[model samples]
Target: MQIQDLPYPDPGVPDAHSGPRFLWWLGRNQLGGQLKSLAWGLLHFTSVTGLPFCVGFAIQAVVDRSGARLALSGGLLALCGMLIALGDTFLHRAAVTNWITAAARVQQLLARKTAQLGSALTRRVAAGEIVAVSTGDVEKIGWFVEAVSRFTAAALSVVFVCVALVVYQPALGIVVAVGVPILALAVLPLLPRATRRADFQREKAGRATELASDTVAGLRVLRGIGGEELFLDRYRAASQEVRHAAVRSARMWALISGIQVLLPGLLLITVVWYGVGLARDDRITIGELVTVYSAVMLLSYPLRHFEEIAMAYSFSRPSAKRAARVLSLERATDTAGSLDASVPSGDMHDPATGLLVPAGRLTAVVCGDPDAAGRLAERLGGHAAEEASSDTSVRLGGVPLDELPLDSARTAVLVQDKDPVLLSGTLRELLDVPGSGDITPEEALAAAQCGDVLEALIQGSLDAADPMDARITERGRSLSGGQRQRLALARSLITDPEVLVLDEPTSAVDSHTEARIADGIRSLREGRTTVVFTSSPLLLDLADRVVLVHEGEVAAVGAHRELVHGEPRYRAVVTRETDEEAAASLGEVLDGGVVEGGLRDGVRDGGAAKHDPPKKDSHQSHGSKHGKPTLSDVLNELEEIEETA
Candidate 1:
């Protein structure tokens, strides 16, 4: 059956009630296997119980007549023992199979849910929590499932043995039967405490997993900032919390275990005491007394499952809740009717920023904050908005983005991040994304400036015809930072999305390589609407138009050179250099002397302008006559100039 077709109850708010429902749901799904296991467990337990009865009969026969009859009874007892041994081995095998299969089915359900939720999975649950649920939680749930049949067999054995005793000796039989249930149910009071502690421990463990995953993901950045020690300390603290939680959980379990052992022992003593009294009174046979004791002893085994099932349920219920939370994440809306998978052909517009990205044009978005750029990119790509801003609207060809089907929207707009994931595979396989064969690998590689990557791939024995056959290590860990970024860019380019949104695509590469890639991308994506969010001068210079964003609003829109010369704030923000020439020009204007440098030099001289023409050695020698000015000095001068103008 298809994964989608698998039956799963909407595990509503996992709590005490949900645990039973989950088990019922699992049983319903695997009814055949469960029934088989139950039958085998009953058969095996019955055979084991029969051995004690056979021994009692043999002893009684020997007492009554020490001839052929006693020998016949002894042989019968030996045969029963062998049968009991054989049944037990098969029963154990069947029960274990049931446990493994049940756990596997639950794991499949979780895996399917993860696939359905996709990227939305992380928004609702931690990565570590998912890991814990799939691994540890599934096993615990299986333990409870397997225990069900074992417990059933144990309860039946107790009843069967009690009936035999009653027929043989009523007074002793009643005590054993009545006291077995009391011993089994003795742990009920401790269950609530155990469950609570287990829940707490699982929660803390999930947090520790999340912290570790986050730390590992950002290890490079942490080391770069010399904050690895700080993060490590935080992880240690979280680990300690998890340890304490585990100890708390263990304490409750230990108490329950003590009761499980102590209560059963007490019940056994009570049974023996009553049986011995009947024997001394000459009311019951010695063989009958031994039979009664063996039955009680056998009943203890199943009684343990009762306590264990309670503990397993307590632990698994919270894990199921976590898994359910992840499964509940809503997928992005698919607006294009399922049949309309056609590529979109039009300009992209964001009314929130009053920005128009014209079709067949290269657009550069220069936001003062990197986060703002990233958010905008996410919105344009049809991903969920990171913030709650009703005023913001992204549209394609005048169609509201939200109205478009998710698949179509995604196909039309692609957002390539600075660090895109590279699945383990040969470099050729990595480049071959969806719609790969439509465009030649050579074209995509050239567009992404991947000539060197291609050489490395060939050197590593990657064949063009069987690119997917190449093995990529986990997350492409074998690749350098820049190679990984370029490979991701290449994958996106291969898709040939109608509107491509790139965030700092060239941020990791050197200037020379960045410049080459910038030119190649402009040429390769000539007729597509491409919005590149970057502070790199080479990429900025290649854009047809640059939109400057400040204070969460569009401050200006113009060609890169025009924006550099006309907008002092844009230059300061992008280049991160002081506009000293602009300040000096302001002083000259105030002194009524012609500024020696032109407007380009005035604004570009001291500041780094992303689109400013390359500076010659001679230009560097030129200095402002006024004292060295900072970007703030330029801003102040611009304010004065604006007032005078």
Candidate 2:
């Protein structure tokens, strides 16, 4: 595959059995590219190996005083030089092409695996390992693949030079041929220890990379808890360990390099010693001795590739294995059935949890165990296991979810995970979802109660009022958790699918803001099939029906209020203790006069009547700058009112 045609329409199934096999598979897949590289490599090596022979021939012609022969030798020398130039240029191009295409193919395979596995990928592999594989591992794998042709050509040239020597002078040819293998094998015994050291280095580096990624991801939390120094020290230690391991591995390779130089130098001396004796005894011509000497010296260059190829294999073997392990993973769900002609659009049912979500109604699921809830949510969204078990299926519209085409299943249902990521882009781009849905981007944002989110974006950017055009940093890091959660919710709401499964949709927001979001969602999705997995009383109160998931199965189904009053377990799970505590918390908000007597129930009530609008103040005076009340301005106005009251 060419670099331009990347993301190969299909990277095709990888072998994935072992590293060597995987490498072979990669080579086989790019057979055409490999052949082109091999051809160029052969041309380059042949020209290099032929140069010494041309020089020896020139010396013979000069000694014979044959002018025509001298001219012929000069022409041949020029031809060799031209071939070398052409070969060098084309070889570079071919090697580069091979390297880039191989890397692209591996990258595509990894990307496909990531999409297929979703969040499960991290569960199976370390985030650092994945990152390392995608970056450094990919390059190493491509390097070995690109070196294969060069190594093969070098080996061939070594053999050809040895054969030419034997034809010219048998006594010296035997010594040269025998000594080359000795030089190549001298480093072989050291390779195993070297490989082990390299593996250790790679492992330590992966750990360091993982630590760095985790540290960056939690930097805000670390700062809040004053743990930044602790994490930094830990990362510093990990980096040191990686550095030590790398130095050790480098020492082993350096020893191998020293041997490569020493043995070849000794072998060249032996060949020259034998050739000089043959010339002195009149057993071989002086010109033949020069040819023998030149050939032996030329063979040293190709011999170096033998050691290089060994090193390449050693490094790339582990890299290929890691990449193969990642690519071999298949999604839990089976998507092989081509039965999309008709889909049963009815209530959604999960056999594992025995929870049924009736069509055209909002159902809330409350599970004591969040892990169980997440798993159930996965099944509900058609992410079933590969092998069907008794508890494996979730039926949507009376149809087995796994039977639907992958795309069809996705369009039919959308599960907004608890920690959805907001990719780096403007607000408009973030919300521009793909799939047929009736919900407009504006409608979804409003339904998720994202007024503050919009204001935060505008305040943090040059743009003021146009939230649609405001830029968001990667993963929405600039926003608070609540803001990020709300933005993710809005993105999901934009899809407006036939079935929406939300897992802890309001976990990050305050009770007041969550209440408003709950109210807005209910109103926006009045007639749609929506399932919310949350135990928040505010959200539970808004559901058309509440299902209590106990011990991994449905225990009761009823109205939120009825369950709260009648079921002690449900009450314990969904509500705080005693009315006194609830009353006391509300009293604290009012007595402290925190932000408009803390009557900011407009955040949850979904109505302006509950919380009066902030009176005009200095902050409000500048609100018209953005053609609207910026979120910060509204917040400041409320604080002013609270202080005055």
Q: Top model by lDDT, which number? A: 2
Candidate 1 regions off by >4 Å?
Answer: 1-27, 65-124, 156-169, 332-345, 386-393, 397-406, 457-472, 578-645
Model 2 Cα lDDT, one tens digit per residue, 107-153 = 99999889766666786788878988999999999999998988888
Residue 518, model 1: Cα distance from true site in angstroms: 2.0
Query: What lDDT does candidate 1 reach at residue 643?
Result: 73
lDDT of 2 at 215: 84
RMSD to the hidden true structure, all candidates: 7.0, 7.1
Superposed by TM-score, candidate 2 places the C-alpha of residue 542 at a distance from the truth, in angstroms, of 2.1
| lDDT tens digits by residue: candidate 1, 292-353 | 78777776676776777787688777866665555445445433464455656688878777
What TM-score quantifies how close candidate 2 is to the native fold?
A: 0.84
